[model samples]
Target: MSTQPAAERETVLIRSARDVTELVNSGAARGSHAKMIVLLALGGIFLDAYDLTSLAYGITQIREEFGLSPAGAGAVTASISVGAILGAWLGGVLVDRLGRYRVFMADMLFFVVSAIGCALAPNAEVLIVFRFLMGIGVGMDIPVAMAFLAEFSRLRGKGSKGSRTASWSPAWYVATSGCYLVILALYFLLPDSQHDLLWRFTVGFGAVPAIVILLVRNKYMNESPSWAANQGDLERAARILRDSYGVDAVVAEDAERPKRESKPRASLHQFRTLFARRFRPRTFQALAVALAQTFSYNAVAYGLPIIIASLLGQGDLNTISASLVLNLVFAVTGGLLGMRLANSAGAWRMTFWGFAVQLTALVVLAVIGDPSSTAWVLLALFALGGFMFAQGGGPGANFMNFASLSYPTELRGTGIGFNQGTLRVGSTLSLFFFPVLSASFGTGVFWVIAAAPLLGMVALLAKRWEPVGYDADAVEHEYQQRLATPEPARG
Candidate 1:
């Protein structure tokens, strides 16, 4: 059963379900481990948000300094998202192969190194390269954090209930807004001659959270017990639950969990398993939703500062700061709404309505507003930020669930990874194209951009099914049974 010798001590008892209930509801469950995991997981998101917003704020300054054309500026802007696409794919594979804790730790280390590299870059080329490297860390961390959040949040902590995984990512946005606030404060404090260091300091400050979390990771972090269970090490899984979160999960006497028939253990095989017929619908759903949302969100929501600065006909830092503050307010509100609905309405439902509302708001903005005129621009941004709240709260919650539910426990990280990876791809495309589109199409670009989520709404309405109340084990069992005994073809 346990690979360790019989004489080795067990960390916590794994006797019964009642003990699990007790442990999950206990004070310790909320105090150290849960809080630590959530805070650590948010680190990458904070960096991602801060970098995008700060870079957007500094874009005009950077472009003038580097003598960059709009296209050249866009390239620097798009670099991180491009790198994130590759990083998410690589990180997903590594997480499935090396284990979640290891890959997560490695990702944080990458952030620290990348942040310093980004700060020290001498030119646009070097900045792009460094930003891409930083993106790799950003890409990998989102899905891993989701996986961590899904597992950690499930154990009904004090007043914390079922699968409110969406709330997890939004916490990082709060951290992100904090970064923007810091940068804004620095702008007010420093003289105009020192502007170059402003962006550098913002990027540099991102690594602090990562370093702080990495140091304490081993002291409190726990591996996913469900993931261990999927690997057939029920005893080890049980041990993790008991020791890490103080949960008392029962391990069978044999100390091995049952496996799906013909399950594959290799990483490549695990990747393929995600696309198995049983999983294809959900996989597609995850991909579509992740892709559409990133395209829309980054193009508009994170792009708010730039959009607002342009409309105001003012290049002042104060203008950008005010817009960002508004965006953060909506983001937090959206996150709270999504967290509240994630369990009650079902992930797909929340995601669908969220996207629908976002689309409606975007269309309203396109219909009533003009970017070239300063008068209506602030109103457009308010609508943009308001819609963003739904996006973050609604789809933000949904993506974690989508990532977590689209595969068996053994490959949960892969599911989350691939979905986030797909989102990064979409974000990269938006990053590269949105500027071109906006420059060429002007106000018409908003209307055209709204189509992405309209398609998402259609996709969800056509194919999405409820997963909230569905037990993972039951789904796997029934899916396997249907596969084994095919029904005769009807004439």
Candidate 2:
């Protein structure tokens, strides 16, 4: 080793796009930077969870106000997700083409504006339109935000223990818990006199937080180092590492001849390369995880307040509010533990066990199928709690983590966005179909929900892939090399 410090050595240099990640993975040195990325991702997801979950609590009131039929109500609820599918695909393209920080600011503005529009809407039609608009923002945020977190996670130093991508689990649980808490408070504070206005206020309340997030983001947000380097701006990437992430990266004189250990930059056509035979299976794994998690969770978790009201007796707000509180507590608790465990055990382990927990819950609910019985109702609540606990720690949090982390930096945004798009498909399906199914089948609806997790389990067993400690650049490079050779690549 040279006697001079790496930072002071004039000959030191960044050779490839991976150099950005190498420095970032330096751990605590990237604390404020990583924290900022985490906070941004957390805020974006929080707004999404709040906006998406808040509607569940308000739908009854909203239905009453708009005189909606079951089909209409379902359509309205699913509309946001419908818009999200398109937004996610488009957002991924934009982030890769335009930039992360640019898309980040614009998406928040979408949420802020749509929240206001939803609050002031005079009819169900108008509210649905705005919610759809808001969904675009929600959809767009995931790819960039998750990409930001995954890229910043850096695999070196302290972060070597657990990927920074793990922060998303706890952040999302906080958002869900926060939504329940806010809804609970709204229920208590608003009297019967203001019952009709309650949903509007609660939904619109999201705007204030969005504004606060905007302010913090304006001053602090910076482009992803890997992205900058990928765009052939190594100097800017180095500055970002040193200034924003506390990494003192220095470019060696022989940067043109990169150290053999450094991963070379990938071509710009990386997004198109995702569908190749080698990557197709991994893509399927990501889609399966996202779709399964969203479809199952949206059916029960999003509709918990309504489910609680119906099970415990519908007239009193206290019972509904209490159930919401309890459900969120369990979810947040489970999410925190899962977040901790995912870092240590890997996301694949969490997803496998998570499905197992949900499977048991669904089966028990199916067997004890009488909501009329007090004991059965209580058991249902316990089962619900158990399922949420597993979800928070397992697939709910890791779906995006895997999507964002599994791909090369060039394709990370597109990969996560693709996952979000699939998630929206599941969300729209469940949100639209669940109310109708529940109306006809009652708690028997859970037997169907159970099928989603079961499929996830089967896929996991058959595919047998894991992303923990994955090497995105090397993996992509290896795939490319295999393609160049005569034979196909195989494990």
Q: Which candidate is the best by TM-score?
A: 2
Candidate 2, residue 226: the lDDT equals: 75
Q: What does candidate 2's lDDT look like per residue over 61-124, in tens digits?
A: 8888899988898988898898899889888877776778899889989999999999899998
Highest lDDT against the true fold, candidate: 2
Measured against the true structure, the TM-scores of the candidates, in listed sequence, are: 0.86, 0.90
Candidate 2 residue 479 C-alpha distance from true site, Å? 5.0
Q: What is the lDDT of residue 424 in candidate 2?
A: 87
Query: Can you write out model 1's per-residue Cα lDDT over 5-101, one digit (the tens) per residue?
Result: 2213333443433233334333333335656666566665666666656576666667777888879888888898888888888787777666678
Off by over 4 Å in 2: 1-12, 26-29, 156-163, 252-254, 257-271, 311-316, 478-491
Error of 1 at 108 (Å): 0.5
| Candidate 2 residue pairs in backbone clash | 11-252, 12-251, 12-252, 13-251, 13-252, 25-154
Each candidate: RMSD: 5.5, 4.5
